[model samples]
Target: MNRFLVLPLALPMVALAAEPAGQATTPLAGSDMAGQLGQLLLGLLLVIGLIFLLAWLLRRVQQLAPRGGQVIKLLASQSLGPRDRLVLVQVGNEQILLGLSAGRITPLHVLKEPVHLADAEPATPEFAQRLMELLGKDQKDKS
Candidate 1:
């Protein structure tokens, strides 16, 4: 068994060593190495691009997830600690105060009269508007 395995492996090495003296190694060895390196880099770039595509698809899928209905609306949230928060929620005519911590949500109280917070600014500006604002600031700063 050992001889059979040894012979099979040795035969290839022996054949490789038996090349004719007149036929030296190919002169395009360097070019072959460069081609192989380029092929490797292209494969790496393709894999990275595929990963980014998958990540973008995942974000879009999550954003498009169905929310059922707007039965419950969050009024406001205040962070008490790093992992704890007080959340005010409204459902129909009822308002609830809830305490939220890691892995648990506890109802703190039920408001007889609903507490409404002051409304914040309207919807945020898109990328173009934000970019124009930044450019205007830069121009003003340079003046």
Candidate 2:
């Protein structure tokens, strides 16, 4: 059994030792390596670019779907805890305040009179404008 096992393993080594020494060992040429690397990098970049393009197209397609005709509209939502929230939802003309917990949603209040929201300028400015105003204020204060 020992002889049988040793013969099988040693036969391949004997065959390798008997091969001619003049044969080149390198599988790929030096000049071809750079071209192969460039092709590989280009292929990787193409796959990544295709992924980004698909994501952008999916977002645009989602935005194109009709969104104005929904029956239930979420007016506002405020988080009370990690898993609890207060949500104001408008179903048709009636607005309802809901207390949302982990397990269940309970109706807190129902507004009998709908409050009219005027189309005046927004109460808060845009984030960039607000940041610029704050920085200006800070600079003025320092001076």
Candidate 3:
């Protein structure tokens, strides 16, 4: 009776140990490892490509959106001092000149007739150009 009980348990253990001699027990073969690595790289590249595609689409959509017909338009701005500015803004048909200091905005004037602005050319020079002209005038005066 002892011999019969031991044989029953030993038979299952022997079967579990008996693996086929031709097959490998480990699953990581060279081809399998290469294929898995390829799949991982492809997935990473797809996620990166999708992010760039979404960003490009967002930029295109923003460009297509309407930008005209705004109520307030900045016609021109000039730096009055280090921390002060004079701004000309057009609100609908009325043109307003505003003085902007460090902490306050004062309305300087409102034009009864809107200034006729040329379509292609601006009346005022750029800040950099104006600054260069002032510097040149100062050098000439010193000479």
Candidate No. with top lDDT: 3
The TM-score obtained by model 3 is 0.49
Q: If the candidates were sorted by their lDDT against the true structure, best first, what order would they fall in?
A: 3, 1, 2
lDDT of 3 by residue, 57-111 (tens): 9989988988795788888888989999998999999999999999999999999
lDDT of 1 by residue, 14-133 (tens): 888788543557687788889999999999999999999999999899889876567887887889999999988889889999999999999999999988666753234458888998
What's the lDDT for all of these models? Answer: 0.86, 0.85, 0.87
- In the range 1-143, model 2's lDDT, one tens digit per residue, is 89999999999998888674434455556757799999999999999999999999998998999978899877777799999999888899999999999999999999999755544543345699889989999999999
Worst 10 residues of 3 by lDDT: 19-28
Error of 2 at 137 (Å): 9.9
Regarding lDDT, does 2 or 3 come out ahead?
Answer: 3
After TM-score superposition, the amount by which residue 87's alpha carbon in candidate 2 deviates from its true location, in angstroms, is 1.1
Q: What is the model-wide C-alpha lDDT for candidate 1?
A: 0.86
Model 3, position 113, has a per-residue lDDT of 91
Estimated TM-score per prediction?
Answer: 0.55, 0.57, 0.49
User: What's model 2's overall lDDT?
Assistant: 0.85
